[model samples]
Target: MTFALGPRAAKAGYGLVAFDQAGSTNAEALASARRGDTRRSWFVTSEQTAGRGRRQRPWIAPRGNLASSVLEVLSVAPAVAATLGFAAGLAIETALRQVSLEAALRSGGRASFALKWPNDVLADGRKIVGMLLEAEQVAGGLAVVAGIGTNVVAAPPDIPTPAVSLADLGVQVTAEDLFSALSDAWVEYFGIWNEGRGFGDIRKLWLERAAGLGQPVAIRSGHAIIEGIFDTIDEQGCMLVRTAEGRLEPITAGDVHFGSVASQGAV
Candidate 1:
């Protein structure tokens, strides 16, 4: 069965689609987009069996978690889709803040949530959400699918890092409510994209919510690992890190690890 977005989301012009179960929202979205679907849809699932993360890592989605993929059919180049990932990250951060604040108000507890560079959302320094974006070439341009998985009730057991849930944090949020907030956030974030701003605004917003800035970190790209101080992101969305040898390195793609030097690490 398919689930549609709520009235608030409908007013935002996002077509919300929900599924009881799916292998992967990103996979389903790509398939739908290739078939020329112009729905501008948000595909949310109750659970995902084969969710994927950056660099083909496994994305765990428990029953009560949030699993969603937002697809946008773009007339721009595929490279622009990469910039959209930054926008998506910012959107998720915004949504987290909204729900966390409400949860805090309801429970009278401290609300703590932060964002890791690229696309990881954390609560009290433990990971609570992760995102994966995939793009495909359609007839006219590229179809971008951004998949977001947020732990709401249960945590996975196989990951190296510690995982936390909203329930564990004293914030009880339902998957549907989280999806509503996310859909609204995406509508606002995508407006920046439609303006042809080229990720400048998104970059600024990301830096504001960034977990590590001016800190030493390690970036793993392909077979090479570079250890440096995280400086800033370049215009092309590449990560700028200062190495131990006092050299500046631009990272196009890699896994970032926060160092132990109160500012330096690698993942």
Candidate 2:
């Protein structure tokens, strides 16, 4: 059950710094970037004490789960940098399929893994993986950390968003095994991303595996609520929602609700 990089990642010159426990793998990766450790690397752990999700929400990975982040230094604008999350989503979804035989068998079915808009991987419409992208201005370039957390053995209780773990769905996988798969898949998707140049391909693949495409969606952005059909993401990764009036509105950031939750207009 030791954590180690897959052959693909290692062969691609990616470094690894595995932690038994950490406050936040993303924070650790960013700190390393600030310290001029700009080499592309992954900071991963099974237990995270103080992680943050979108809008600064706390996201802790309890024991037996996976809390991992990979640092990439690139010469891309922040707008382009933001699109990397899509690649991260694809990586984890691909990895989940690779590690879990059940996940592979269920692919293209209702209970398969799919990417929820922005930064979540859903299994049977319940979230199993959450991702966060953080960036900082460094000496050489933009340092971006893609943080990925997977519920391996257990999911948090009483969460606003429905959550599920691999074990819960009958796909038993260890954190170490999952990370190995993830590292390999990341190498593939990261190459396709090509520091954002390959985002077009990523976007296309993402839309193909999107969870709520063509469904009613309600996005809570600040104090405004925008309700519409999930149209697609634009070239720059802004979510394009087709409203009732037939106008396509671009959402830069928001909390997306779908299905019954969107019907009720809940956050």
Candidate 3:
């Protein structure tokens, strides 16, 4: 079956390639960028034999899940490019809402459908979507790949965190359908980002849909564990964890847990 984005992708100067199965879409997106294919493009697949989330942990998806990555070419510094993770997450949220996620929310289920910290979309505190940002230097500028995977038809089993899918919520959607919405939503969000000039807006909107805000959470970073209330994400996209001493520590990277029963992972 051939899946593709209609006119929105072409209007945005995007060229796309898809695979029936791949080890990882992020790897393919980066490779396409390195091969002198300059136009903005996306790599997509429905089945992934090997996928990875934060900390190189396994990210498994069924045949109907959406596995996609976009090759973003920007001239900004690495710090600025990193903020695109927020853009990607926001885009996915917007797309899903447009595709009737809001209607699904009213049906009453365990899934609340909200964005999790750093880069994840949670349904009733279980993760429905996750993203990984990968960056490297290409010839004239920086190349970043925002890899996203959504559990549309099926969620992976036996994971550290609780996972949910659209099907589980009684909302029917396919990987191709979600990707079509995502392609357009990504362009809209990218315009809102304005090459990182509009991060303030992104931060405000992201916090509004953020799950676990003002709630206690735990983060595991390197050899240490930090426990605190879920404070607002700062201007630079770092998570602010307000410790018991009332100090707000910035978390730029870590595996965050603490929101539902499936939380509390090993440090």
- Regions of candidate 3 where Cα sits further than 4 Å from its true position: 101-111, 259-267
Per-residue lDDT, model 1, residue 13, is: 76
Q: What is the TM-score of each predicted model, taking all chains together?
A: 0.92, 0.95, 0.92
lDDT of 2 by residue, 173-193 (tens): 789999999999999999999
Give candidate 1's error at residue 244 in angstroms: 2.8
Give me the candidate number with maximum lDDT. 2
Please, what are the lDDT tens digits per residue for candidate 3 over residues 39-139? 68899999987889988888877698999999888899899988899999998887777665544565543245688889998877788889999998998
Clashes of 3: 2
**Cα shift from native, residue 26, model 3 (Å):** 0.5
Superposed Cα deviation of residue 167, candidate 2 (Å): 1.1
Clashes of each: 9, 0, 2
Q: Which stretches of candidate 2 lie above 4 Å from their native place? A: 102-111
lDDT of 2: 0.91
Residue 36 local lDDT, model 2: 95
Model 1 misplaced stretches (Cα beyond 4 Å): 1-8, 195-198, 261-267
| CA lDDT scores, all candidates in order | 0.78, 0.91, 0.84
